[model samples]
Target: MTRPSDHDHAPAPAALSADGGRADPAAPPGAPPGHPRRWAGLAVLSASLLLIVMDITILNVALPALSADLRPDSVQLLWIVDVYSLVVSGLLVTVAALGDRFGRRLMLVAGFAVFGVASAAVLLADGPGDVIAVRALLGVGGAMIMPSTLSMIRHLFTDPRERATALGVWAATAAVGSAIGPIVGGALLEHFSWQSAFLVNVPVMVVAIAAGLWLLPESRAARPGRWDAVGTVLSIAGMVALVYAIKHFGKEGFDDPGALVAALVAAVALPAFVVWCLRIPHPILEIRLFRRRAFSAGAVAALCTSLAVAAVLLLLAQWMQLVEGYGPLEAGVRLLPAAVGAVIASPAAPALAARIGARAVLSGGLVVSAAGYLVIAFGPRPLSYATVAVALLLVGAGMGSLAIASAVIMVGAPPEKSGSAAAVDETSYELGAALGVAVLGSVAAAAYRGDLPASWLAERGVTGATAAEARESIGNAMEIAAHAGTAGAELAARAQAAFTTSLEGASLAGGVLLLVAGVLVWVLAPRDLDVSGSSHH
Candidate 1:
């Protein structure tokens, strides 16, 4: 099978124009000949996406340095880490709608400028509050950039086949960015301040802004009706509440009052938002798109894949750093198998889907990921790095199906609704990741605590506050063990074993979840679905 090259010179389908309507063959001289620089524009969009995705993970490596400099309390530290995601989730729908109403290129350029300015501003961040503010600003920029990239791609690549290949490159870039964030952050922090983790975005954004303006074409919804302020408010409230509640639940469990209240807000606001969108002629989001089986299946595939992978990847990173005593950079490099697998598989997924059905590729990817998780869960005792590497490779390969998911989603919607389609697609990813970390992370925490019971801790003179801290997480347990006398070695060893057990339990749960998701997607997605065309069926 020949792979589609970036220089695909296929003519646009005569039946479908750039706007997903019938083309006019009798057009007069100098009619819009479509963007000649579209492939170059895609490169700019991918670069923007890489930076935005990288920002999400790079902070993990910078947190220690930032915390030591600012000496923030626990709550402040959590905010520093989480505020970015919260802001991004909240603003995604609203920002995407604005991009459609205004121009996607304009939104994207402004986003680049904002991201650059915010990163440079980190130099003046002396307190936890200042850092949190910068992170929130960066989230705003990320929200503006994320959906624009997808919607712009829909406009740029009118040919479904070319769009699929472009999306494949987009997905591959995202995977690489996410995997390498920590490596980049670690490298920066070793030589410069923690601020360097952020400041690095400045130069890249500068170049992206220039390239984007030069290479990207301006596009927006042709018939964008009046703005829905109520929908905007509800969307912001619902997404923020939903994400905050999930994070709170992950940290404090389901019984926390704050989490419950946030969940209530999400439940109320999201339903109201949906109803409002259905009523409005020009809804902030095209909620009706979910009625399409292909679109819905694509969203489910994105959500479940992210749900199954996020927590496991996070835990593996922690396992490398905390249990194996690898430095941040070393741990990041060890985590690269998934990235390597994704990079190799993503670009090939579109071609594979073209040969096999889209449904097969999407559902099969999830099955492959399930196998990866099951390998970790049921692999031999005392799992080695080699086993983990193999599992990561499988999971990464499975992630390549996301390119098909994106294609199905974009092609399923009309060109005018691309912003909404992009927003929904990205929302699935954000919400799925939050759900994964909350649910599976909680399961892991429970398993860890169950293994290190209070009674068992007391028997080892690790009672009261110290025992509670040990029960909380392996990181805390290791810290306590470091200060303990001779018994510290035994305690550390037991904690490590317990953490390993918890990881296995979580892997089992994630594996089962992925298997269920795979079956559901297979059932939901049409057997004859062709992603290389605009028609859903």
Candidate 2:
């Protein structure tokens, strides 16, 4: 990571109470931006973020076509799906460190070049291995590009308030990318080959490169010491293992030997890496940043917000498609309310943070988001689109608190250390998303199984083994029902009812979890905290 200059020391704990946060609490709202070119730079940054975020989901819709063309085995297909994230998660801290030591602009441009070239190469992929290789390359490009954009934003907007506002716009990109990826992928696949999915990134990367070169400024740590190569390796291994375990746990549960092994390695390696960072003179990242209330509070807010969004969004998507019988495209379109809410809330947050303080905004937003979940939980049976739309909007608005989360992270650290801070913030987001699926999904599954009629089904041929298999998932349950003849229809109808009830319980639990998180943040964050300027008190 970026080496700290003498002046780049961590903000003193004592000075924090009086010196840091807000330009001035008594002052009126909204400060001007840090630089004349910062907005233009933000456009470039947003595009980069959009591409990286979109890549994560765009592949989901194209998977069937990808399988048809490449004819990947099931195992190969799983690898193809898992490898990109594993590679990206592995390389994040390493790339962020390189971005700080080497110029962030240089690394970003290089990332764009790699991404463009790798995307274009997909046209030549005739087999699963070829596509897997391309995905790995794209992951490297993503790791390089993602942190560069965030750190660059830290440099681009020096004023804490302006930076917070800029970050809000940046945070909205996540919502927008999720909302758009399916639509864009669907449109592309309708008229072109599946390769078009990858090929599309080429032109966008080109535009991003040209704009980045023109609009972005170069930045790096001023006095970076000897690079910690060992720490880099440890971080890569630890994160890769952690993410693999998380993804595996979400899909196959915790019993798999591979997942257990990965989780063990991650649990061991991560703490060792932390200890390594603490002992070293010029560490990979300042792990101590977590000690600060603003930083920790914001990180918690970001994580919990992501957990709520990811888990609820999964259930909501299934409800809209499977339960409500909407087409895939229609369900995706209906979910756009969340994106719209985020777009509005993101840019508006800095002013709000300026007025009531970021602590309140962060905590308050989570509570509001929880209210949305409550609406989902207790709304009239057979879900209503109007009610869901309103709920999605609230969820999105609450997630807009991520703007404050980003600010607390970046503002709490020195500009030169932006890469490390960005990596931490980004990791929190990814981990939260994964955990949300694993935890809430497991909860929902239990509720579904519990609500199912057990003894009645056992008397039929659908006893023991068959019933056990059906209870595995809603999709499996429906599939089993479809071929079970007359008796199965009743089972299928009941399964649907049970699944819907599970969603209610899951939504309620998720809402309560978010409320608890909001309370924790309310206690952890300070009331007078300000990010109006540099917070290195």
Candidate number achieving the greatest TM-score relative to the actual structure: 1
lDDT of 2 by residue, 178-216 (tens): 779766765676778879879999999999889999999
Cα-based lDDT for every prediction: 0.76, 0.71
Candidate 2 off by > 4 Å: 1-42, 57-89, 113-137, 153-175, 186-199, 206-220, 243-256, 414-419, 441-502, 534-537
Tell me the deviation in Å of residue 155 in model 1: 5.2
Q: Candidate 1 on 60-143: residue-level lDDT in tens?
A: 666555754676543454467556656776677788778878999999999999999999999998898999899889988988
Residue-level error in angstroms, candidate 1, position 235: 2.6
Best by lDDT: 1
TM-score of each: 0.84, 0.76
lDDT, model 1, position 439: 66
The deviation in Å at residue 441 for candidate 1 is: 2.7
Model 2: how far is 532 from its true place, Å?
Answer: 1.5
